[model samples]
Target: MNAIVIGAGVVGLAVARALAMAGHDTFILDGEPAFGTWTSARNSEVIHAGIYYPQGSLKARLCVVGKEMLYAYCATRDVPHSNCKKLIFAADASQSPKLDGILASALGAGVTDLVRLSANEVRKIEPALRCEEALLSPSTGIIDSHAFMMALLADAEAHGAQLVCNTKVTRVVRKNGQWAIYVDGSAEVAATADIVINSGGLAAQNIAANTEGLDPATVPPLYLARGVYFSYSSVLPFHHLIYPIPEQGGLGTHLTLDLAGRSRFGPDVEWISEIDYRVDPSRHAKFVAGARQIWADIDPTKLRPAFAGIRPKLSGPGEPAADFAVLGPADHGSPGLVCLFGIESPGLTASLAIADLVLHKVATD
Candidate 1:
């Protein structure tokens, strides 16, 4: 089968690899010149353990599976990553039960290594920090997202898959048991054997709407939320990723480190209407206020607007967190077409798992 995966982000690249491994002639198409220049580039780079998600949710299932696969793949490909662990800190003493809930969620997701710590014990791990209670996650870690994407590309290419850059999939049409893909405003199209997985990320909603024969009802409404990240100019005191127990909508302001050991804080979730990457410098005050609850000594000068990422959040803020919605024949009524929506947060950690799920859908459909 000839499989065409639109979008070359982490999820798309991972899906390409999985499809090629499944004996399909796989090709990844991206409007961008390079892979992961969007959400995959601008993220916390933290590989979250399957915590904070409700039980039986897709985020819970895939992240738990994908985190394990990601670790193994990193080791195999010599990708730079760290199981440096995570600390879901109880910044507010009254919020201690939230931390307990996080532990329970992780356990329900099939992780059991979580250990509770008292305030002094939390200080034992990082004496410079202040916290009333915490849960230690040995499985949580960070990855060089670029290196990880490169590894996926390498594997996909080695297995006879190809990437088509600057090839924007303008429209898709299903005719006579095959998908005809039009790229870059050109009428010239490519025919696929059976499957056409639209892992278009931010542009997914738009892509499905423009497809010549695709039903609009099959594609869910896209909720674009811009998450802004900030960087600390100083040395990081904490060795592990410090996260607050997430609220219902998103993770609160937290500190994460890069492979270079610089501290970056991010993804303070802000709802937006469209794909906007503008980092509001004015939000620094709010970021500082939220971050100080975790790091009391946050220097205003060190906190600078670094980068921003727009999540394809299907759900809005202040609502119940939603599940990963990957529409296949079962949902879309299209036998060989797959559409993925609301693949946010653990999307990176769940990249491989999503890839496998997509491949299975392609195969079984």
Candidate 2:
């Protein structure tokens, strides 16, 4: 079987790897000069333990299964990662009930390793933290996402998959029981394959809209939610990833340490009209305020503007969070094609599971 996967992000690479491993000739295309340079690299790199998502949703299911798969893959493949754990805390006694609700939700999502901690227990583990209560997720961790993607690409190439960077798939037309892919405004078809998976991250909807046989109504509107990161100038006193309660459009401003132990606070949700990666210097004060909720002794002067990332969301502000949309031929009545949309948070962690699902859907549908 010949397969072509659009978008060279982590999810796309994973799908390509799976298809190639299944003995299909696979090719990966990306508009950027390299793969995994967009949303895949811009996230907190935290391996979520399936908490905070609605039970039975794709986010919950894929994240739970994918977290385990990711950990195992990293261990065997020598990919740099850490199961350093995470703490979701409540600032005051009045907010402690939220911890119960979170714990219940996590349990429903098959995350049973969460340990409820009182303020004193929290102080014992993290002396710098000032919280009324907390939930310690032992399964939560971080990964070197770039290394992970590089490994996936290597495996795919070893299995006869090819990656073409800067090759933007402008349109896909189903003809003669196959997909004719056009790239870079070329009038002629760039390639043809029996299976075409639209895994474009932020540009996914646009690619679907351009596909000839796909239904226009099936394409969901893309909402860009920009989250800015502010890196701490020095190492912090926290050993675990520190998070507050969930916020609208994202998890609260949390502190995540990279592999080198450099800490950063960030990703405050801001809805935007256009795609922009600029970190607003004025947001420093807002980040400081959010940081103080977790650490009272954090020095504001040490916080500096680091970077920002935009999430290609399906739902808008004030609306309920949307699930990951993996629309195959069964959903859209378009055979031999699968379009993935609203794949944002926990995407890096769930990349492998998502690839498995995509392969199964294309095969069965």
TM-score of predicted structure 1: 0.96
Question: Candidate 1, which ten residues in sequence have the lowest lDDT sum?
Answer: 185-194
Misplaced by over 4 Å in model 1 are none
**Looking at candidate 2, what is the lDDT of residue 221?**
93
lDDT computed for candidate 2: 0.93
- How many collisions per candidate? 0, 0
Write down the lDDT of every candidate, Cα atoms only.
0.86, 0.93
User: Looking at candidate 2, what is the lDDT of residue 124?
Assistant: 98
lDDT of 2 by residue, 1-365 (tens): 99999999999999999999999999999999999999998989999999988999999999999999999999999999999999999988888898889999999998999999988999999999998889999999999999999999999999999999999999899899999999999999999999999999999999999999799999999999998999999889999999998876578899999999999998888899988998879888999999998888889999999988889999998899999999998899998899999999989999999999999998897
